[model samples]
Each structure stands twice: as C-alpha cells, then as structure tokens.
Target: MPEHEDKRPLAERIAADIRKKIMSGDWVPGLKVPTNEDLRGLYGTSNVTIQRALQILKDERFLDGQAGVGVFVRGQGSQTIMPAHYIAPAGPGQPYRWLSEATKRQQRSKYRMLKVAEVVPPVEVARALGLEAKSTAMLRSRIGFLDDQPAELVHSYYPVELAQGNRLADRRLIPGGTPALLEELGYPTRSQDDVVSARPATTEEYEALEIPRDVPVLEIFRIVYSDNDKPIEVTMLTKPSHRFKMGYHLEAS
Candidate 1:
C-alpha cells in the first residue's frame, strides 16, 4: 500500500503534504517558507504537529532553519536529489547524466581535476580492476561541484596499457565524459556493475566534502565493461549523505 493510505505518524503525513507543495513550486527556491504557526493553522493542528512535519523536511534538506529568522527554502543543494532511475543505459554513447529530482533540472557542475597520472592502485581498487598487486594504472582524480559546493568526488582508474596514447592522461574533461572516450578507443562499454556502501567520513573527506564527523558518506563504486565482458575502467565516487540521496527503481517479479 502507498504511504498515504497507511496510518502512518501524523508528522510523516504532514511532511508529505508540505513536501508535495515544495516539489510542485508552490514554494520556490530562496523563498521564505511558512512558519510553524502558519502551518499549524493550515493543517488545523497543534504547533507540535507542525514542528514535527517541518523537522522531517529539514532532515531531508528540503528546508533550512535560521536561529531567529523563519525557515527558508534551500537553493539547488537542498532542492535536488540525484536520480537513480530515468538514467540512460550504462552503455556507450549514453553519458551517466545526474539530473535533479526537482523538476528534472540540470545543475551546472564543475569538475576540478586533481591527480592525473600513473599511480599504484590501492589494494581494493586493484582487485576490482582485475590488476595484480603492485601494478600501476592511470588514475584521474576529480571533484564535482554544484553551486560552488563540493558534491561528488570521483577517481577513475584505467590500465596503463589502455590509457597509453589517449587523452585519459590529460587533466581535462573528456568531451562527452569517460564512457565516450572509451568508445572512441575501440572499447565500447556494454554494461556497468555498481557497488554501494556507506562508511564514516575520513578526515580528508570531512574537509574536502565540507561534511562533519558525525555524518556518513555514500560510496558508489562502479566497474565499466566493454563488449565480451572485459572490464576496462573502475570508478570510485563518494558523496556526502546530507547533501545527496540515491534513488533506485526496482522491478517486482
């Protein structure tokens, strides 16, 4: 049964109503959202009920509360969640586009390339890439930003043999992203395998992602496959939990 049909907590039900309004543009970015008193009157409920509902949205990053001032709608950061569904096939000629769940909007993201050189792969990365221990691979490390806030950190590893004579070694954005470059190199990607896990943020992650110690980060690690089941590239991505949410579409049998 749908959540609305169930006798869920009153706060959750109220949260759903406010969430719908926020999503539908009745409340827009940078707008001052309704206060607890206003919501209480609107819902014909007590202040406590309204506060609880607003707390749910605040946790989801839909709203931000000021100490003395009223709550306000967050801009791009809070308003958008990356889409795990409606994504292009994890294949060639189809870039892994991340779209905003808020009206499917596209945020202008900037890629800040870090290390782009051959490096010894970490034990886990090497294992995932099918490389023997002590093997060297071309590593491209970068961080993505939305509205000048660090959003996702990615590291792409390619076998030295596969990266030779290619722009993969360059510190720049490939014209159409990594998949397109792989396709041009005669290794068209045919599939993708993803592994997701969460762990406490490291010191570097805390500073780099501007997240606190108490917050955990989500890791989306994936291996790209070429035709004939050849694993060509492995990418590790990390995103702060409070700033992003992952959505999944499942098909029931």
Candidate 2:
C-alpha cells in the first residue's frame, strides 16, 4: 500500500506507523528513529507534521532526544499513575491495613530503591522532621515505576532514631516497603500535605533519568506527620509531567 494513500490525521498516522515498528523491535532502545527529513520523505509530509508526531511520542516516554544527537526509541510500554486521594491513617494497627487497601485500588504502581544512607539532616529537612540541624537521618531515594515503567524519583528523609537498629533498612526486606517499615517501628498512622510544581529537569536529573531537555517534570513535596501530628518524614517526588495527572477530591467543610 502506498504510504501517501493513508488519509488518517498526519500525526496520528505517523505515530501509529512508528509505534508498530517499535513494537516489532525494528527500532531498539538507544537506536535513533527516522529523522524529520527521513519521515517527511517516507510519508510525503511536511517537517512540521513529522515534528508533531515525534513530540507526541516523546511525551508518551517512548522516545528521547538529544540536542544535536537526534531522537532515539526509548523502548515501549511505560505506565504512569495519577495521584488520587491522600489516604489518612485511621488508627493504631489500621494504617498499614488501610494502606494495603488503598494501594490495591491504585490504577498502577511500582518502585525501586536508588540510594539509602545514614547522614546528617539538612537544615530544611531537619526543620521539617522537627529535629535539630545536623541531626542524623536515614535518607532513602527511590525511582518508582508504574506498571513496570519508570514513574517518579522519590527522596525520603526519616529521623535516624526511627531507623536505629531496625532491620527494615536491609535490602532483603523486600516485601516491607517504606510505609510498612515505619509501621513496624511504631510510627504508623500518618498524614501528609502534598505540594506540587512544574519545572525543567536539572542536568543531574536529566542524566540520571535519561529524560530529554524538552520534557518538564512535576515536583511533589510530601510532608508526613504521625497520628499525633508530629512530623516524622519528608519526601520529594519528581516525575515526568506529561506522563502523569494529579487528581484530588475536595469535600465541603
């Protein structure tokens, strides 16, 4: 069939054509996709149409482009989860149970520990955790995946006192996620205030996550407090903005 005979929307048709090639492994990860000129010639379309199609794929996290290095296929199938209701702790012995229920309802979810260390808390982090500056803290950074796809990078700070002598820090404690670990240490049932913003990725972040410069990221600040309203942890979550949607429900006071 003549490619020009395909009368579909230019961008959609282009994206569909490329997506098929990707799925068939014709273009592997790190392999450059057809250039704008290449695509234009193949589809008999303008550079603008090709650009739009490429942009769509980039937003979908299926392609990564370098300033002068060209665009490359980023593999296929990365899932993203939208933020939902902020689950509140019900009571003692109930928080973990409730969390399990909440997570089950999540449309998608995944996580990977990136870095874990014991270090002195920074001034801002200490203040958030209600501790003195220079106080020891357990810093854990993770890259969360959703449906087997990279989603967000999260850095969590916890007072060292909370993790002292706890086996939860051990990598072998796989099933016991961070929240569950806290619960085991008797700091369950917490509440969080989430603040969100959008910005471009820093050089370090871009390299670490292999994100393109044109992509903006969503930064989420989560301050968690115990049931008694004592701040126990602070988390910073950074995610590709285009891949996610943040949703919340507000009730009448």
Candidate 3:
C-alpha cells in the first residue's frame, strides 16, 4: 500500500503533528517522548527522519534532550493569553494587566519599546483610526517578553492629534499600558473590536519573534472605541502560533 502524498517534507509533517500534540496539552510538559524506534514505527519512517523531526521540535523550544534518559517536553508549554483580562485599565499605581498576569504564572515579563514615530500606518490600521489617505499617525511599536523570551510584537497607532507630544509618542514605556494612559487623556475606552487570524509570518515578524518559517503568526487586530463609538486606537499584536493559545470566557445572559 502507498501513502498519501503531502507537499511538506516528511520530517516537517511529523514535526508539525508532534507540535500540535504539545500545544493541545495532549503531550504534557516534562513527559518523555517515544523512543526513536517507537516514533519511526509509528510514523512509518526511517530513524533519520524521526531524528530530524525531533530536532525540529528541540530547536523550537518544545522539547529537551537528556544524554541518557530521553527527550522530554519542555517544562512550560504554550502559554494561553486572555484578551479580555488585559483590555481594561489598571487601577491607580498598579502594574499593567499583562505584567500582572505573567506574575501570576511565575514568569518575568516586560516590554521593550522598538519605535515611536508619526508614520503612515498599514491600510487596515489607518482605516480603523479613521485617517484619510496619505495621512500619518503616531505609531508605538514594542516587543513584549515573558520569562525573558520574546513573546509578542505589538504595534499600536493613535491619531496624531491625540498623541502628538503625548506619552504615546514618547520614547518610553507607558505605565499601566496604553489603556490607562488613554483614560487619563479623557478617552476612556467604552468598547473594543477584535479580529483574530493566523497567517504566514512576515520577514520582520519572523526575525522579531525569532521563530522558524514553519511557524505561522497569530494576529490580533484590535480597535478600541471611546465615547460615542469614536475609534481612538488601533493595536496589532503578533505572536508565534505554536507558542500561544487564545482563551476566552463567556457567561450566559
């Protein structure tokens, strides 16, 4: 009997399957992977192929190898991020919601400002901010870290009229994140719209996230509206798909 042909290389396909298991919680952290012989038999592939697949996982920080024991899943697997939990402004003198959540997970977190400038944003972002053609906005870009690992890339845009000479355009970290700052600026968020999607990583995203080409990026395009449904901000967040899980909770009315 012949096998179905898959466009991706055999090793990549196998690695992808193993990655899914790890991300799905089926392959729990610190669990030993099947032996090379077992994997080869299960996948109906050669030992070299199995080794290649395992190597891919190792390179992606999903697996760790011991000299004599075996390869085991990393202690901390993919992290789940709840969008709702971090959307609101923090209380007075409180850390940003994201940083607080990371603390609860026992992970060190911080964000490094990448660039703050007034520039023409992406078409979607520009449109979301209600900007006209060829108009520019204040852009604040940064890389968020968890446990010292680059976890997400964030690019937020604000209307120049609202951000010029403001902390949003300043080259520094805004305490309590932009949500709190916006509230202080008299634009308390009244609502938000989020659109999540997965796509191939762009070159900048690939380099920024330090992920391989096989890993796609998950994008969260969020538009925050103030009073009267006026869109005041647009934030785009990018994360490695395999390393993050989006979580949401709902209550029956």
Q: Candidate 1 residues 2-113, lDDT tens each?
A: 7558687788889888766676678787889877778887888889888888888787677899899889877744333433442233344443444122224545666788
For candidate 2, the 10 contiguous residues with the lowest summed lDDT are 90-99
Q: Summarize candidate 3's per-residue lDDT along 1-253 as a digit string, tens digits.
A: 4486578889999999999999899999999999999999999999999999999999899999999999999998998899998888998999899999899988999999999999999999989988899999999999999988899999999999989667988989998988899999999988889899999999989999998656889999999999999999999999998889888787999
After superposing candidate 1 on the true structure, give the runs of residues whose Cα lies further than 4 Å from its correct spot: 1-69, 73-104
Candidates 1 and 3, the one with greater TM-score: 3
- What does candidate 2's lDDT look like per residue over 105-199, in tens digits? 66355556677888776677777888775677788877765556566687778877776777545533234355666666688746788898888
Question: How accurate locally is residue 51 in candidate 2, as Cα lDDT from 0 to 100?
Answer: 92
Query: Candidate 2: where is the Cα deviation over 4 Å?
Result: 1-109, 172-174
Candidate that would win on lDDT: 3
Q: State which candidate has the highest TM-score.
A: 3
Ranking by lDDT: 3, 1, 2
lDDT scores of the candidates, listed in order? 0.75, 0.69, 0.92
Candidate 2: the clashing residue pairs are 110-145
